[model samples]
Structures are given as C-alpha cells and as structure tokens.
Target: MVAFLDEGGMVDFTIEYELTPDEVGRALHRGLKLQLRAVRLAVPTILAVSGITCLLVDAIGLGVGMLAGAVLFPFVLAWSARRLAKRQLTYLCVPTTLRFTDDGYEYRTDQSATTMRWPLFGRVVSTPEFWLLFVGKQCSAFLPRRAFTSEQQAELDGFFAARQKAGAL
Candidate 1:
C-alpha cells in the first residue's frame, strides 16, 4: 500500500486502483458533461429538426445552416475527445497508487505523480461507479468505487462530509 503523511505527520491510508479503458471512457464522458453543463447540448437536436423543417419548406440556406450546425460540431467534439483519449491512453491504462492523508491526496502513476490538498478540489461528485474530483470544470481525479471496500467508501464519505461541512472542500 502507498503512504503519505498527514498534517499531523502520520501516515494515513492507501487505495490501489487499476483503471480500465471503459472506466476511462466514463471518466472522460463525465468530465465532458461537467465542462459542457452550461453549453446548449440540445442545439444539435433542435437544429436537426429545424433543418428538416426548413428543407421541407424549401429554405435551402437555412436548412443547410441548421444541418451543418447540427452535424459538424458534435463530430468535432467526438473527434477531439477521441484524439485526447488516445494521447492520454498510455498514462491512464496503468496501475495507480493513491496515497492519502487527512491533509490531502497523492496520485501516482508510472508516468507522473501529483499531490493536492483537499481544498484544491472545488467539487466532489459521486456516480454509481466513481468518485470524481474537480477543480473548476476540469476533472482532477477519478476514484473507482470498485477499488474501495464498503468500509473504505464509508470512511471517505465521512471524510468528505466533514470537509464539506467545514467549508474546506
């Protein structure tokens, strides 16, 4: 197990996790959703329908514009997502050693290591399968639920809750 010193200079706990591609995909998808929360995702659907209506009415210019908007941007996002994932795949598709303390957390992979205090994460979100840590809209950490025992998850929940209650998270 990995170990990191807490504020009290005590080694706290560790969780070893190996990330899978499907989990990475879910993480990326959730990260994208967080980033795009303010964006009008419905634009594509609306534009597609509008484009069809415009074509039906013989408004070629508007139809093409709407269709183009509906078609191109999502493809761009998809392409970018694919490209980004490919670039980061090597780093992600490895074993990870997560060391943590009451003060912060240390994320370690063979490619890189990062340490961040709890306050650095502006948001913490939980899905059925993951714990997502965010700094602004960017996803900073992906903690798979499968990695933790139920007791560990509960401990983390309490830890997070305490931080949140203290307005430190």
Candidate 2:
C-alpha cells in the first residue's frame, strides 16, 4: 500500500486498483452529460422539430429520417464514448496507486509515476461516485469514493473544502 504524510504529520490514505473499462465508460459518459447539457437538449429538440416539420409538410421520407436519427443518436453517442474510454484506459492497464495528502497527490503505475500539487488543479468536481480534479477544462484525475475508508473520506472532504475556501481549486 502507498501512503503520504501531510504537513500535520498525519498519514494520508492510498488507493490501489486496476480501473475497469465500465468505470471509465461511466465516468466519461457522466462527464459528457454534465458538460454537454446544451447539446443533449438540442439533439432531442432538433429531432422533434424535424419530425414536426416533416409532418406539417407531408414528407414521409423526412419524418422517417428524423425518427431514425432520434432512435439511433443516443446509442451512437454511448458506443463512441465507451470506445474512447476503452482506448484511454488501455494506457492505464497496469495496477495503479494514488496517495492523497494535504499538499498534493501522487500517482503510480507500472510504467511511471508522477506527483502533482493541489494548486495544479483548476477545479474540483464532485460526482456521486468520483471526485474529478480538473486542470483547465480537462479532467486531470478522478478519485473514486469507494477507494477510501470513512475516516479517510472525511479527511479528503476536509482537504477539498479547505482548498476550495483558499481558492486553490
């Protein structure tokens, strides 16, 4: 198990696991849903308008096309997101470990390791299952809530709160 010592002399928790494809896919999909709210709404709205226009103009072909697109678009989006997530996770196939501390965080993989200071994250987003740390508009790292014990989770929550209050994230 990996660990880190904070400035307060407390040992921070470590999480070690191989991230599954499903987890990555779900996270990606969730992020897309949150970030692309307008797109999500526009797709359906446009499809509905197309269908209504076709009906008003008595064009069966246009109506069928809109219907087909409405039915197929979501499946296409999900499939594409899953494929991209799978490709991204292939590079992270090795067992990965993350150590969280008050000052920063460190991640280790079979191939390499890196440490990042807290200020490097421009934003911190908390989802139901994971905490996504963003650098600019891209998510830099994700921490699964299940990886930590209750006490460790509390420590992490406090750490995030302090960072937010300090305008570090």
Candidate 3:
C-alpha cells in the first residue's frame, strides 16, 4: 500500500492524504523533545565516563590516559548524542504518507517510501512530531503532522483508534 500527500490542493494550514502502492524510503527526522532528552542524558553520561576513566588512568600512573579521556570524552559524547538524534529524525521524525494494507504500512517521504509490516511493529508510540510505529528494537517510521491537515489528522487518528480496537493494527 502507498499514500501520497500532495501540495497542489493545499489549504491554509491544511494537509492532504492519498494512498498508493509504490514504496518510498524513509528519512531522518527527530522530535524536539526526544532530541533534547538525549542531549541532556549525554552530558552526565559523558562526564561520568570520562571522570572514571581519568581516575583509573591516574591511579595507574598513566598521565596520557587522563589527558586522552578528557580530550576524547566530550567529542565522543557529542558525537553519540548527535548520532542518536539523527537516527531519531531518520526513523521517527521525518514526514511521510502512510498507506495501510494486508502486509503492512507503506511510508512515503519526499526521498522514498518504505514498507513497515505488522510483524515489524513492536509498538505504536506518539509524540508531537509524529506517530512512531516501531518495527524493531529502535527502528520506526515517522508520520509527521505535515502528512495530514488538522481535520485529516483527526480523521486518521480516529481510524487508527478503531484499528486498535478491532485489533487490526
């Protein structure tokens, strides 16, 4: 299944929805809240890890070890935080049109569309950025607000609610 969100018939602050069979790949997208949390966690984790490493190295009389850890810790932490944030955006924040079918849902973004089957759906979680349909431990497809208009969002939300009730999700 496939879905398309066109811009031609767009209304002010309105979103459009359509379904198609072709699959497009997903993109990098992350929620502001999740990104912030990840960043917040990174600082403490980095400091702790670096502090421990520095102390251990100092006790061992390895002066370079402390210097290395101090220098590398912040860089590694920043990189990790950035990477995780990017992953969240790619797997959970990017905009896409989702089409539901017997197999799974087809998520279409500007770059590509990808199929996310039911078995891959560990759970469905929602955030302001998107409705995350988790496929694996950390894999997900992001359905952004841009995918639907305010009215359409309500309709789609109702549709998913019904599906959940019927155990069709």
5-49: candidate 3 lDDT, tens digit per residue: 446542122233432211112222333233345555665566556
Mark the regions of model 2 whose C-alpha exceeds 4 Å error after superposition: 2-14
**Local lDDT at 66 for model 3:** 51
Q: Indicate the worst ten consecutive residues by lDDT in candidate 1.
A: 2-11
Ranking by lDDT: 1, 2, 3
Best by TM-score: 2
Local accuracy by lDDT, each model: 0.79, 0.77, 0.51
User: Model 2 over residues 19-115: C-alpha lDDT tens digits?
Assistant: 7777777777776666666776789779978987897899988887897887777788778878878888875656988877767888899888999
Model 1 alpha-carbon miss at residue 147, Å: 1.4
Predictions: Cα RMSD each: 3.7, 2.8, 9.1
When 2 and 3 are scored with lDDT, the better candidate is: 2
lDDT per residue as tens, model 1, 1-169: 4434468754377978888887887777777777676554777888999999999999999999999998887777766767777777789889988877888988898889989898898878878788888887788777887877776677777777777788888
Q: Candidate 3, which segments miss by more than 4 Å at Cα?
A: 1-98, 101-103, 108-113, 158-169
